[model samples]
Target: MKLASRIFFAYLLVSVICFSYPVSRFVRDVRMFFLESVEDALADHATLLANTVGTQMEANRFNAEDLYLAFDKTYSRPLAAQIYHFTKTGVDLRVYIADTSGKIIFDSQSRANIGADYSKWRDVYRTLDGKYGTRSTRKNPNDSTSSVLYVAAPILVHGKTAGVLTVAKPTTSINAFMEKEKPRILKLWYVSTGLAILLSFLVSLWLTHPIKRLTRYANDVRDGKRAGLPPMGRSELRDMGLALENMREALEGKKYVEQYVHTLTHEIKSPLSAIRGAAELLDEQMPAEKRSRFLSNIRTEANRIQDLVDRMLKLSELEAQKTLQNVEEVQLNSLINSVLESKGPILSCKGLRVTCEMDRDVVVQGDPFLLHQAISNIIQNSIDFSHCGGTIGISARIDEGMLLLGVEDEGPGIPDYCRDKVFDRFFSQPRPDTGKKSTGLGLNFVREVAVLHGGGIRLENLCGKGLHAVMTLPM
Candidate 1:
């Protein structure tokens, strides 16, 4: 009816089927095994008694009182308590001597049944005809059903067949004993089976929880959320998690590169145009001082363009590499300090308040150089856009083994439409409000770093206002 119930019933059904088969087989085998063992014991006892009776028959002769007396003395000897069923039950177990004509002359229980013809009974008939004979039956006359083991051997005097010695034991007691043992054995089997099923269920739950978490995290990532990957154990699930993380990294890298290229080209277009126009102006006759200034401007623009191009190419190469060559544990707080130190001159000149809000022990696995470049680019972008005394916040935290790096600025936030293209290489503008132009390669470089680290980066408006750059990397 319901999923949980269905699963429970399914498990129960399979367990019952699997458990029932072997247990049923074992029960049957147990019954038969015990039956055979008792039969062997009875046969051995019967053989020994038969020999004693034969000796008595030889000494006491064929007379009724003498044979009966011999049977009495033979059974009187100490033997296994299992041999006596007559005193314990209504059924009689006894020895009998019959002649070659199949006429019984002596019986331990009664002589009345002796003169009665036993030619129809297999044991007496076969013994008279020189063959081994055995049969099982109830000893009581009124009781038609019985389980008694009987064996007959021919008595020999001077190498000639004289009479038959029939030895028997009633097995009602043994049967009852086996019946008593059945419930306990079944109970033991059931207890063990229940424990096994419970253990399997526990193990299944332990295995399924991580997979479910991974599934949810994957879906969130697909929907463009900053969903963190779960911590994984050293098992098959861990391997699967690692593989998914790797795939995410590749997709993120490709996406970052695509955006970076578009922006880089856009930003350089303005500088290239300015340089081209300036070069054209120089071709026309002009004052040497102005011409020299024009040449200097051209060289400066060319150098600026060259630097941007080199950085972009290098970032692209890093993104293309699926696996980082130099991987090590990098501290987020410490790395942030390093980037701030590198930009110390600009921070001082711009009067930018760069605040690092990093957890003391935040760590991630990635290339230190690439990480440095990515974070540096983000901070540099903030510096370029910020007004005097503008605040820049660089913060890092870890969520389920995924490092979340945030770079925020108090500068004017990105426009809605342009937000999507900001990561593209060369895609920058002279902020109409700030009247400042950017190389645009900064965001693109940050994007490549995200890809190379098997992670992703996004630009969003911080809580109320201001721009926020959030980068996610596997820790």
Candidate 2:
């Protein structure tokens, strides 16, 4: 299972285990608790009745007939007492008087047992022996709910024990109350369990969110995309993330330096060879025109080497940076116009006409200097590739919350084999006019700048005979 699932299930299991036992015990003991309360009330009634009966006996006016009449009246009276959830319609109290000999005298519930021997019954037997007594007996042998609780007190006449008065109440009403409340108790348990589950799920997601972000960052880096360190709160994970970022930079910096050194050396070799050959020739005696031609060749090769080194330095600086600095809002139209003006002499010399299709209000957020350099590099590439007297197109527009800036040149479009490598460092095609490759860092630098601005760059072959470079930036 996934980490979140594991966490959620683990938390839920613990919560359930912690909650199950106490709830079960409470549910199991509730009936007995109710019975105890009922028993206490019954004891009070028995004692009071015993005293009243003892007074009657002392006056020689003790009468079972009076008790029978009073109990009958109580049972017959209409009662609609609503006790929380249970309703009481009539009294369920029963009283029986037993003589000192443990023989029943008055049976309020039924007269059939008026003279029955009750010496074996705990309540009657103990009360007659001058001890406090109570007992519970089930009426129906197979039904536990049919149990009745009995409490007895000694009847004393003038401080002499005379008889026993016992009060009884059936547990049917208490059971009914329990039965009515069982579902509500279970419903509360269910609600508590559901809330626990929801809390577990939320906690798992909250704990794993930072890990997911860090994983995405690692994947992006593995894919060679520019990705920044993800935000992780003040925890051990944040410390680990910073450590990982530092390690990645250390490793990438080493690899970057090695690769650049190899490519730079290889690129400069050809120009160095040309300069060496030209210098050797100039050292020999030669005609003025030949000497001048050799000198120009040497200057051209030296300039080529210088240009290659300059471009490489710029690309290395850009690659080393993980984020942009000097952020500001840049007006696209104004920037593009400046790039075009900087290349005005070159455009005039090449006899190229530039057409711009863009709104004046287009703007984006980024480092102005980096934006200018990236755009200038793209325009310069187009200038080098375009045929003399050909037209170049520049356009900018906002689409889907992105600024799409495109530059197109009416030159031979990129070859199919070279298409994918156009944006690769030190990968370039021969310019259509010069029949020579550039330093090959221009498009790559443009791509880096786009990524720093939270955007991307792509090159596409125009229909029939041209190349288009599109840079997309968040607007």
Candidate 3:
């Protein structure tokens, strides 16, 4: 099972076990507790009644008829006693007296039992032998609820035991109370258990929430997405997440260095070979014009290598950054205007008519230097590929809380086969004018910049003749 499930079940099991025992015990022993209370009350009543009978006997005025009349009056009186959830309309007490010989005399419940031998009963037998006594007996053998408790006290005349006065109360009311309370107790148990389970589930989710976020972040990183580390609070898990991030950076840095070295070696080989051949040719006899051409070729190849190295270094710096620094609000119109002015000479030489179609106040938050470079690179690509005297469209607008800056050039659009690889490092298409490919890091750098600004870049073919590039950034 999952960690949350395991934790939930473990918590629930403990809670249920802890709650079950006491509740179950209380439910089981509730009748006994009630019976004990009733027995104590009956004992007091028996003792008091026995003392009253002893006083009357000492005065030689003890009469069974007087006692019977008093009990009859008590039984007939109307009562409406409300005790918590129980109601009492009449008393369910029975009283009987046995002589010194252990034969019954006054029997409140039935006069027919007055002359019966009660010596065999525990209450009578034990009380007649000068002992405190009590007994519980079921009136119906098959019905446990029909049980009655009897408590006996001795009647004393002149400090001598005379007879046993016994008070009996049926447990039907205690049974009634238990029957009424069992369901309520069970309900409380159920509610408590349900709340415990709910609490357990919430706790499990709370405990595992950070782990889930971290897991998702790890997965995104594994899939090579630019996913940031999730917040994990000040716990061991946060430390672990940071550790994982550090480890990933370390491993990726190693691979990055190795890949860059290999690519740089391969890219510089052509320029190095050209420079070597040109240097070798300088030692041979040749026409001045041819010699000058060879020297220019050597300079051009060296400049190409330098440009490639510079772009690669800048792209490497961009790729290493997880977040942006030097962020500020940049006016897109002014920035684009600046780039166009810087490329004025080239635009004039190529006879490209540049059209700026955007609001003057469009702004976005990002690293200004990086955004400037990204825009310049994109426009440069357009300038490189556009047919002479073709139009270059530049537009910027806010749409759906994003700043969409588009550049459309009347140049040959991207080929279907190269569409997916356009933004890849060192991937480039040949310029229509020069029929020469660039360092190929410009678009990739633009992509990194867009991503760092929490945005993206995309290029599409504009109808039948041009390429449209759109860079979207959060406004």
Per-prediction TM-score: 0.67, 0.90, 0.86
Q: What is the per-residue lDDT of model 2 for residues 233-270, given as tens digits with 9 covering 90 to 100?
A: 89999999999999999999899889888988888888
RMSD of each: 7.0, 2.8, 3.2
Error of 1 at 6 (Å): 16
Off by over 4 Å in 1: 1-60, 66-93, 101-103, 110-112, 138-146, 157-162, 172-281, 323-334, 355-366, 394-405, 432-439, 447-456, 462-464, 471-475
State the C-alpha lDDT per candidate.
0.76, 0.91, 0.92
lDDT of each residue in 1-475, candidate 3, tens digit only:
9999999999999999999999999887887788888999999999999999999999999999998998899888899999899998997799999998889999887899978998999998899888878999999999999999999999999999999999999998998888899899999999999999999999999999999999998997886667788899999999999999999999999999998998888878878999999999999999999999999999999999999989998988888777786899998888988999999999999999998889888878889999999999999999999999999999888889998899999888999999999998788888877778888889999998998888999999988889999999999
Q: What is the lDDT, from 0 to 100, of the residue 168 in candidate 3?
A: 97
Compare the candidates by lDDT and give the number of the best one. 3
List residue ranges in candidate 3 displaced over 4 A.
Answer: 26-32, 82-87, 100-102, 116-120, 126-132, 138-147, 157-161, 172-191, 330-334, 355-363, 395-405
- Displacement of the residue 200 alpha carbon in candidate 1, Å: 8.6
Residue-by-residue lDDT tens digits, candidate 1, 246-349: 89978997888787777777667877997999989988999999999998989988988888888767866864564578999998888888889999998898
On TM-score, the leading prediction is 2
